[model samples]
Target: MAEKSGKAFDFKLFRRLISYTNPYRFTFYFVALSAILLSAFAVLRPLLLQKTIDESFIPKDEKLIVFYISLILGVLLLEVIFQFLFIYFANWLGQEVIRDVRVKLFDHMLGFKKQYYDQSAVGRLVTRAVSDIETIASIFSQGLFMIISDLLKMVVILCFMLYYSWQLTLIVLAVLPFIVFATRVFQKKMKTAFEEVRTQVSNLNSFVQERITGMKIVQLFTREEIEYASFKEINEKHKKGWIKTVWYNSIFFPIAEMSSSITIGLIVWYGGLRAAQGDVITLGVVIAFIELSQMLFRPLRQIADKFNTLQMGMVAANRVFAVLDTHSKINDSGKIELQNIQGNIDFEDVLFSYIEGEEVLKGISFSVNAGETVAIVGATGAGKSTIINLLNRFYEINGGIISIDKKRIDTIDLKSLRSHIAVVLQDVFLFADTIFNNITLNDPTITEDQVVKAAREIGIHDFICSLPGGYHYNVKERGVMLSSGQRQLISFLRAYVSNPGILVLDEATSSVDSHSEQLIQDATDKITEGRTSIVIAHRLATIKNADKIIVMDSGKIVEQGNHNELLEVENGYYKNLYDVQFAEVRDV
Candidate 1:
């Protein structure tokens, strides 16, 4: 999470963000040049208006009047052209920069270890990747370049005002210090307000996402009203955040308008007195000073608003950079390629923990030879699932050497190693796409024919065809359209299509019905035949045919043997566990 800074502008962060625009350097430079040209043309219009009044109208020269009018029109036309270029190029640069930043942010997230996600909310990450990045785009499109253009126009206008009458210019600028002081106060207050708004937006997104995802639980527990009340509170906070920004704007803009009016009044009063004295000031000069004063003070007011946009963008950049700067990436230093891996897995004195000082796998040693089936049975929280996680290197181990085919696992390339391993977890996840896509996961090489063949081999082809559209059916989000048993079968088909050398089934059959269980068992036998398999068994009968059974208690292996051999022990943990946990299944 990013903390809000009290500084009005984070120049260091601004510089870092500007570096991303290097790729579109040409467009950025063009926009900057357009701003300069716009200022020049804008200032020319007022000077032309002053001259037309003083030289052409007073002397009543029609031809001169026509020439001055044409020149003023040309300046206006040039200003319009430059304005168009500025808007187009600035927006183009913003879009290009944000596209690159979004890709970089997503790629960085992909490299983060599972522990990072374990403690983070998915909605918060989504907000940073989507909404916050959009806010940063305003920095270029509406904030930075616009601020520069306004400032340049003000400077040019001030120079012209002084050229006309230094005394009148001083009179016009008397109230400017008060306006600048007010603007500083507005910037500081609005920065804090914008930060609060962003935080509230993230909280609102997280709350809504979680509630929708867990709607089943909420309904089952009859928590609709309670959840709605909580949401109302969050929504109220979000509303309040925006209202704070509105309140500040309301207070500051009125003050700015009052200051502008007062400056114009002071100039008119003093200039009128000077003209009355002895033609020291002209009528045209007084009118031009009014125009110049508006140009100067107007941007001061707008600069406050644009500065708010820039401040919000900086806050978003800070949050995004915080995610990029995280050092919790898993080490992928392995250079070895395990082509045609034999699937001989060995865990030597492995010690692990998901949290500090709370060891989950304590000095555990185990091995599964090539083409062997190993079943691990344990009570809940006996670290059965932890083994699967460690095998796939999802979490780093504290102390251990896990090897494949007598080669250290860490020495193998991360992608290549995971390519040869398949895991079918108890809670299977499927995308909201076609069944064919769910099975093949849109792998270009794995064609529709290949997926159908894999499904048929696993005896799920007929079951799939029974559904409307067969493989083309949309499963909706998270495969909600499918039953629990059907989803498990789809997961099996997905694993089988991959043809992995090592297969891990972590309670894969624990949540299915009897018919789905039969389908899964048939698929399991076919897929695990020629590969090394590790089964985290919940039901003892599921592992009765295994080559070896390892019973675990409190992160340590208590017994290791085949079913009959283990049952022969008088008071063995497996024997007692079987009687207590699986005797009813056996009778049924």
Candidate 2:
């Protein structure tokens, strides 16, 4: 994790992050321009104070005092107004840069082939999008202003201080090397502290997210206490990291106070003598030195705090940069577009495995004719889903090819390829929105009529109408407001609405009740009427009417024929499995 954050704070990452704000350089300059004028105006106030103390107040000149006081008030008022606009623009620039980076990252994530998501967690991506991006945003907004204003103020004040008295300026300068050294030491420690904090926070976030997602499981197994304890551990780890930062800052502040006071004392004791001994120094010059000390040390305190802030931003950068640096596992050489396609799919001795040396689909070869309804049957873990995954290019085959109408899928553009196919998964996932959005999934061209027609075909439109708000009613996340059967119908509607050339129903009806199953079957027949459909079914009844039923075992096709043909092969693996399911259906 240190390595990860180390990369985040890298100069190159900041340069890239800075480049995003480059487009708004004029606005940044306006802020800087205002700051320069404001700082100039700011430094003049102390000089005005010195004049009032020595010339106006002591000599009892009321008019001069009033004049100086009015000027001071006017400068303060004007600077505040410009400073307001400057800060507003700076904040806007920061947010805009964040928006740009987030947009670019999301677009890139979408371009990454499906395989990348298969290997990564949603939690990490969530952190990158929210927390990590916010870090860079802060650096751009608040950090940039502090950096620019402090630097400019430091340079200007130092120059003025030197012009006043070279001897006194040198004394202030002597304290700086120690101040910078102390800051440098704390900076290294703070960086480690902040990086650890970020890491622990991510872990805690992941843990809480997991528990919330699996709340039912935790309750069912009576592990809520266990999970809570586990969560507390992670959360406390995060707190410890943050506490370390607070502890160090507490120590550093007193040290800063001591150093600053010592410098001021050195001035009062040493510079006072020169004033008393008839040197060129006046009460005004000594007073100016005292005022200058405040300017010098306040920025020094800010400088110390700014280092801590930089470390925090750098910690955030590490995670964000890591994600941006990731290269997608899949890429296309040239664009391939398909206007129309006949749904003839062929698998030529395809070999695939999720894990090395453990082949899931070993040299499995098959062919489906145009408009064929092929039922792929298998016992659990017999590579049925693996086969479905291959057709859609979810995972590339280690050997052989998946071709549609004899055109290789690898050569086809992913968008074009997926556009021709749709799958209804076993775990039906729906958006937390209206039924309209859930069915359409934000496809702009899909009309309301299409949504109704698709839902109607899947036998859920009437059920939706019966709900209080019907289709406009909230769907809730994962369609939790509805039954398992209703969710299945929604998933089915998604598949049918696509009007895809190739349809895959991977346990699509597994969770549906019998009545809903029959309705889904009717809709399935309608949708797959002129297209090829691949059904991965465990239910014996659903696959009975398929044009072909192929039994899979240990990643190889053990038997192939229609349902009756497989039943007739009494001596095969098909016979025993058929007897068990056949008996259960009759019992039901």
Candidate 3:
């Protein structure tokens, strides 16, 4: 990861980000007001010191001293009250900002074309939304709090120092240029370290996540030792990243503290001798200057700390913007609107390629009327799945047209077009929620009764009912809590629940055993009764009842016929596949 240019820290991103909390304006205003009020105490409490020394003590008046002391206590009490308010609001804003960013990020991720997911890793996307956003929020909340308050306090102290003595003010302020120069250097080094930390940490997260996800496979292949050693190396790199961050911070804080202390000691010594030389400055004034000197650099120290935090936050903000800035290569023009879909689909001379000059679907042409079922069968990478993807507009066709009911898909608003399609894949992914939720994920507004009904129609209701919590039973990662057959059944239920005009079942029943497969076949036959359906599978039996069987080879349809007709073609690929299946069955 590259450290952002100095110009990248401009307020544009921050201004845009603050708009996320536009709905919560009152919260923001009150927090800002409270911070300002709390910061005013820096000037007020120190003025009390000046008054006690220059007036109350000079007159030897105990009552006046008591009065000034009481006023200082009151300012302290008010400061504490506003400080509480400031803390509360900043904390609330940080959480809300993080929540808003995550919500928007997830929504955009879903809208992204399939190609994005194919290129991006789940762990990296998660880190962007969770870890990166959280780090930025911390800077906004706690770090920003320290920065604003410290700067305000320093300004007030500087003004008082100038008013009391310009000569002293000039002497004391000379050290500021050195501090600022040092801070700029620290920020530059820390930024580089911060970038290293980000890249290493994310790399570590990706590696660990992948290892965990494939841990069972590793054990099956006896690769545990290799995986463990690789993990240790990545972990060490992450540790080194942190070490660099700590090294910069360690040098920064002590240098800041020692410099401030040395400046204060110099002030006391020089001011002491000046007073002895019978200058117009009083003993009381000298004491007040001493007190003010200590308070002066307190805020400066805070500013120094915030500089490091700001660098880290800036690094995170750049990463987040890079994600939010991504736009899909294909998106609808918002002109096409379909109130209803008849599911008449056509692919007119369609050509597609995920990579340049390597067409996956070469001039594919097909049409299916409403309520017709089409089967696409081919060897692996023969472009059977690619054809379905183009039909659903998951990928923009490199050449030619795809339309539904005579309306071109690209012209139709994507949301309207996609709403009419339901897809069930072999690789099932159920949320870590109840079975009812997983089935009705497409239509969350559906009632529990409707969910159960859909499940029954799909032939999975009875089995689900037998589970410990019925439809409410939890489905863990990839629905590992349920059997493979059960997961497939739930996927079938999900597709059916949408009542889509067109259904795509891609190797949907591959996981089920023979008995459950028979059940699912019966259920799908009923489900696709009046819908345009496309089935892609290696198993010939699954698509036996399809209205049209499309046999593809080398990215082109080589044959098209019904089961009996295809079997009659002695030289056809479908005939060869059927012959192989029968020969294997007879041998077994």
Task: Give the number of the best model, judged by lDDT.
Answer: 1
Error of 2 at 267 (Å): 1.5
> TM-score: which candidate is best?
1
On residues 1-588, what C-alpha lDDT tens digit does candidate 3 reach at each position? 232556524466556666777887888788877767776776777778778887788788999999999999999999888888788788888789778888887777777888988888878887888899988887657766667777777787888889888877776787777776777777778778888899887888888888888888999999999998998999999999999878877887788777777777777677778878978666666777666766776666666667667767767877877788788646778587887688899988988999889988889888888889999998999998888788778888889988899998998888888888988888888888988888887465888888887777767788888999998899887788987777888888888888899999998887689888887897788788898999998888888988999999988989998899999997889999988988887899
Report the lDDT tens digits of candidate 1 across residue range 164-271.
898988887778889999999999999999999999999999999999999999999999999999999999999999999999999999999998999888888988
**lDDT, model 2:** 0.81
lDDT of each: 0.90, 0.81, 0.81
**What TM-score would candidate 1 get against the native?**
0.98
lDDT by residue for model 2 over 1-588, one digit each (tens)? 223534324676567667787889898788778778766766777777877777888798999999989988898898789788877887788789888888877877877656778777677777877888888777755676766677677788788888878888888888877877787777778888888888887887777777888788999999988887887888889889999999989988888888888888888887889889978666676788788877877777786687567667766766776777777745565267866889999999999988899999989888999899999988999999998777877777899988998889888887788889999899988888987788788899999898897777666788779887887888787778988877887778877887889999999888788888887887788888888999999986888889998899999999999988888886877777888888987899
Candidate 3: clashing pairs of residues: none
Q: Give the winner by lDDT: 1 or 2.
A: 1
TM-score of 2: 0.95
Sum up the clashes in candidate 2: 2
TM-score of each: 0.98, 0.95, 0.93
Q: Model 2: which residue pairs collide?
A: 8-317, 8-318
